[model samples]
Target chain A: MSEFEPKIVAYCCDFCAFAAADLAGAMRLQYPPNVRIIRLPCTGKVDAIHLMKAFEQGADGVFVAGCLEGQCHYLEGNLRARKRVAYAKRLLAEVQIEPERIDMFNLSSAMGGRFAEIVKEMTQRIKEMGPANTDRRQQPVES
Target chain B: MIVADRKPLEEILDSIKDYKKIMLMGCGGCVTICFSGGVKAVELLASQIKIARKKQGKPIEIIECTPERQCEFEFIDAFKKDLESAEAVLSIACGVGVQTMSERHEDTITIPGQNTKFMGYPVEHALWEERCAGCGNCVLEWTGGICPIARCAKKLLNGPCGGSSNGVCEVDKDTDCVWQLIYDRLKKLNKLENLMVVRQPKDWRTSTDAGQRRVKFEEAML
Candidate 1:
C-alpha cells in the first residue's frame, strides 16, 4: 500500500513561529513538505472557527505554533491561543472528528530546529492516522 | 440580558434535516451579546452545515439574516422575502424571539437553534452567571442590593438556610450563599435591622404563575 501524505495546515504567529520557520530555512533544516504555514499577527488571531474551517476545506491536520509561554509579543496571546486550541479539539470531537488531528505548540523564535522537528513530528502522526475522513458520511446538517 | 446557549449541533442538524432550503435567523439582542446567536454565529453555522451536507452528498442551502432584535416585529419584518423563500427557519434567538418569529411568519416553520438559559450577565468574556429571577418583586433595597431570590440556592427570604456553611450553599459547594451575601451587605450598610422584619410570601400571580403576561404601553396606544 502507498504511504499517506497528509495535508497539514500550520498557523504560525508572525513574531515567533513564523520567524522560526524563516530561521529553519536559513539553518538548512529540512522538514516534510506536507505542512502549509499561514502567518498571523499573533496566535490569538487563530480562532476556533479557522481551525474548523481548515478541516472543512479538507486539511488532514491543523496546528497553531505560537510564542513560548510568558513570551508572547502580545502579552498573553499564546496563552489565549492555547485555550482556543483546546476548545477546538473538543468541538471537533463533538462532531465525531479525531481530536488528535489538531494541536498547539509553543517555542521561541530561535528554536528553528524544534520548528522543523514539530513539522516532521506532526506529519508523521497525521500520516499514521491516515487521511481524514473527508469522504465519510457526515451527519445530515439540516432536515 | 437573556442569556442563551446554542443547541447541540447534532440536535440542530437533526431538526432541519429534511429541508433543502432553510433560513438561519440571528438576533442582535441578548443572544448576540452572549455569542450564541448573531451574524457571526449564523455565518459559522451556515458554513458548518454546508460542509456537513457536502460531505454526505446531500447539499442544502442556507439563507442568513440577522435582525436588530428578533423579539421585535419591526426587525423581523425586514426578512419577509427571505422567510417566504425558505422552507424552514432556524432561529438562533431566545425563546421569546423564536416565538416572535413563529408569530410573524405563521406560514413558515420556525425551529429554535438555542436553548434559552436565564436572565444573566457575562461575568467575563465568555463566562455568564444567572443574576435575576424576575420574581415580580423588588426586595433589593432591604437586602442591600443583593438578590436572595436569584442568588440564593434556597431562595430564603429571612436568613441563611441551615445548608449554608462558611458562606457557601449546600446544594453546590461552588455557589456562594446569597443570604450570606445579603447579610454582609446589610451589615455594611447598617441596615441589618431589615432582616428582622417578617415579610409576606411572594405573590406568584406577578410571575409566570399567572399564565401569559403582557405589558401594554398606554402612551404608545394607537
Candidate 2:
C-alpha cells in the first residue's frame, strides 16, 4: 500500500520562520515538500479562525512557527501567538480532534535546520494519524 | 452599567447542537463595554463554534452580527434581515438583551451566551464589582459613596458587623469593610456627623420588592 502524504499548513512569522526557510534554501538544506507555508506579519495576527480554516480547507496538520520568546519583532506578538495556539489546542480537543495535529514551535531567525526538522516531525506525526475527519471534510454522508 | 461574563463555550455549543445555521448576536452596550458581548466576543464565539462543529463532522454555518444595543426594540430590529436564514441566535448581551431578542423574534429561539451578573461598574480591566442594588433610595449622604447593600458582606444598613477586623471584612479578607469604607469616605467629605445620626430602616417596598419597576418622563413623553 502506498503511504499517505499528510497535507500540512504552516503559518510562519515573516521575520523569522519565513526568513529561516529562505535561508535554508540558500544553504541547500532539504526538507519535506508536503508543508505549505503562509507568511504572516506576526504570529499574534494569526487568529483562531485561520487555524480552523486551514483544517476546513483540507489540511491534515496545522503548525504555527513564531520567533523565540522575547524576540518578537512586534513586541509581544509571539507571546500572544503562543496563547492563541494553546487556546486552539483546547478548543480542538473539545471537538474530538486530536490536539497533537496542531503544533506551535519557537525558533530564532537563524535556525533554518530547526524549522526543517519541525516540518519533518509534524509531517510524520500526521501521516501516522491519517486524514482529519473534521465536520468540514467528513469522509462520507451515511445513508 | 450592568456586569456579566461570557458563558462557557461548551455550554453554548451544546445549546445549539442540532442547529445547522446559527447567528452570533453581539450587543454594543453594557456587554460591549464589559468585553463579554461585544464584537470581539462575538467573533471569538463564532470561531470557537465553527471549530467545534467541524470536529463533530457537522458543517455548521455561523454568521457574526452585532446590534447597536440589544436592550431596545429598535436596536434589535436591525437584525431582522440577518435572521432571515439563520435557524437560531446566540445573544451575547445581558439579560435585558436576551429578553429583547426573544420578544422581537418569537419564532426564533434566542440562547443567552452570557450570564448576567449585576448592575455594577468595571473596577479594572475585565474585572467588575457590584456597586448598587437599585433600592430606589439614595443613602450616600450618610454612608458616603460606598453602598452597604452591595458592598457589605451582610448587607448591614446600621453599621459593620463584628466580622470586620482592621478595616477588612472577615467574609473575604480581600474585600474592604463596607462600614470602614463608608467611614473613611464620610470623614473625607466632612460628613462624619451624619453617621452619628441613626437613620431608620430602609423601606423595601419601594425597591425591587415592589415587583417590576417602571419610570415615565413627562417632558420626554408626547
Candidate 3:
C-alpha cells in the first residue's frame, strides 16, 4: 500500500509566516510539499469556523502561523489567532478528532528555516494521526 | 434577554443522526445576544456536525439559516422552500424559537440544540446570570431591582436567610446574596421602609407552576 500523504492547510499571516515561507523558497529549504499555504492579511482573521470548514472540506490537518507572540504587525492579531486556534482545537476534540490535528505557531518573517520546520512538523503529525475522516472507516463499529 | 447554553455536541449529533439533511436554524433575537444561537454559532455547529458525520462515514448535509426572529412565524415563513426540502430541523435558538418552528411546521421534526437557561443579561464579557423568573409580577419596585425568585437560593421574599454568609448565597459561594444587594440598594435610597411593609404572601398563580400563561391585547386584534 502507498503511504498516506496527509493534506495540511497552513493559514499564514502575510507579515510573518507567509514571508517566511517565501524566504524558505529563496533559501532552497526542502520541506514536504503536502502543506498548502493560504496567506491572510492578519492571523486575527483566522476564525474558528474557517478552521473547521477546512477540516470539513477534507484537510487532514490545519495550523495557523503568525508573528512571534508579542510581535504581531497588526498588534494583537496573532494573540487572537492563538486563542481561536485553542478554541478550534477543543471543538475538534469534541468531534472525536485529535486535538493535535489543528494548531497555532509563532514565527518571524526572518525565520524561514523555522517556517519550513513547522510545515515538516505538521506533516509528520498528520502522518502519525492518519487521515482525519478516513481513518474511522478502518475501525470496527462500536455498536 | 433569554440566555441559553448550547447542548453538548454529542447530544446534538445523536438527535439528528437519523436524518441525512437538516435545516440548522439560528435566531437573531435573544439567543444571538447570548451567543448560543446566532449566525456565527450556526456556521460553526454546521461545520462541526458535517466533519463529525464524515468521520463516521455517514456524511449528513446541513442548510444554515438565521432569521431575524425564529419565534416569529413571519420571519420563518420566508424560507418555506428550504423548510420543505430538509428532512428535519436542528434549532439553535431558545426554547420559544424551537417550539415556534415545530408549531408552524407540524410535519417537520424540530430538535433543540440549546437548553434555554434563564431570562438574564450579560453580567460580564461572556457571563450571563439569571435576572428574572418571568413570574408575571413586578416586585422590583420594592426589592431594588434584584429578584429573590431568580437570584436567591431559597426564593425568600424578605430574607438574609441564615444561609446567607458574608454577602454570598450558601447555595453557591460564588453567587451574591440578592437580599443583601436589595438591602444595600434600599439603604442607599433611604427606602428601607419598604422592607418593613411585607405583610402578605405572594400570589403563586402568576408563576409557571399554575399553568401556561398567555396575554392578549383586545385593541391589537385585527
Candidate 4:
C-alpha cells in the first residue's frame, strides 16, 4: 500500500504568514506540497467555524498562521486569532478528533526559511498521525 | 440578557441520536451575544455533529435556522415552514426559547441545546456573571446598583452578615460581599444613611416562590 499523504490546510494572514509563504516560493525554499494555503486579510478573520469547516471538508490538519505576538497589523488580530485557534482546538477535541490536528503558528514576513520549516514540521506531524479516520464513512445513511 | 451555555456535545448528541434529521435552531438574542447559540455557533455545532455522526456511520441532516428572537411568537412563526421538513428540533436558545418553540410547534419534538444559566451580562468576551435574581423588587436604589439577593451569600437585606472577611463572602471566597460593596458605593455617594433605614421583610409572592408570574400588557391586547 502507498503511504498516506495527509491533506493540511493553512489559514495564513496576508500581512505575515501568507507573505512569508510567498517569500518561501520566491527564495526557492523546499517544503512539503501537502499543504493548501488559504489567504485571509488578517488572522483575526479566521474564526472557529472556518477551522471546523476545513476539517469537515476533508483537511487532515489545520493551522492558523499569523504575525508574531504584539505585531499584528490590526493591533491585536494575531492575539485574537491565537485565542480562537485554542478554542477551535478544544471544540475539535470534544468531537473526538485529536486536538493536535489544529494549531496556530506565529511568524514574520521576513522568515521565509522559518515558514518552510513550519510547513515541513506540520506536514511531518500530520503524516505521522496519518489521515483522519473519520473519513472512512463515505455514505451517510438517509432516513 | 439571559446568558446560556451549550450542553455537552455528548449529551446533545445522545438526545437526538435516534433521529435521522433535525432542525438546528439558533437564537439571535442573548444566546447569540453570548456565543452559545448564534448562527456561527449553530454552524460549528452542525459541523461537529456531522463529523461525529459520520464517523459512527449514522450521519444526520441538520436544517439550520436562526430566528431574530426565538421567544417571540411573530419571529418564531417565520420558521413554521422550515419546521415541517425537520423530524425534530434542537433549539440552541435559552429555556424560554425552547418552551416557546415547543408551545408554538405542538406536533414537533423540540429539545434544548443550551442550559439557561442566569439573568446576567458578559463580564468580558465569552465570560458571563449573574447580575439579577429577578426578585421582582428594585433594591438598586439603596444598594448602589448591586443586587444583594443575587450577589450576597445569605441574601442579607440589611448590612454585611459578619461572615464576610475583607469584603469577600464566606459562602464562596471568589464572590465579593455585595453588602460591603453596597456600603462602599453608598459611602462614596454620601448615602450611608440609606443602610440605616431598615427595609421591610421582602414579599416572596413576586418571586419564583409564587409559581409562574405573568405581566399583561393592556396596550398590546387585541
Residue-by-residue lDDT tens digits, candidate 3, A61-109: 9999999988987899999999999999989999998999999999999
Top DockQ: which candidate number? Answer: 4
Q: Residue-wise lDDT of candidate 1 within A8-126, one digit each (tens)? A: 99999999999999999999999999889999999999888898888877788999999999999899999999998998887777666789999999998999999999999999999
Regions of candidate 3 where Cα sits further than 4 Å from its true position: A134-143
| Interface RMSD, candidates in the order listed | 2.4, 2.7, 2.2, 0.9
Candidate 1, residues B1-222, lDDT tens digits: the string is: 999999998898899999999999999999889888988788778767766676666878889999999999999999898777799999999999999999988888999999998998988888999988888878888889888888886677889879999999999998889988888888999988998999888787877898887889999999
* Candidate 2 chain B weakest ten by summed lDDT: B50-59
Which prediction has more favorable DockQ, 2 or 3?
Answer: 3
Model 3: fraction of the reference interface contacts it also forms: 0.83
- Docking class of predicted structure 1: acceptable
Q: Rank the candidates by lDDT, best first.
A: 3, 4, 1, 2
Clashing pairs in 1: A142-B16, A142-B17, A143-B16, A143-B17, A143-B18, A143-B19
The Cα RMSD across the true interface for model 2 is: 2.7
- For model 3, residues B1-222, the per-residue Cα lDDT tens digits are 999999999999999999999999999999889877999999999988988888787989899999999999999998889888899999999999999999999999999999999998888988999989988887898887778888887778876899888899888889998999999999999989999986477887998869999999999999
> Which numbered prediction scores highest in TM-score against the true structure?
3
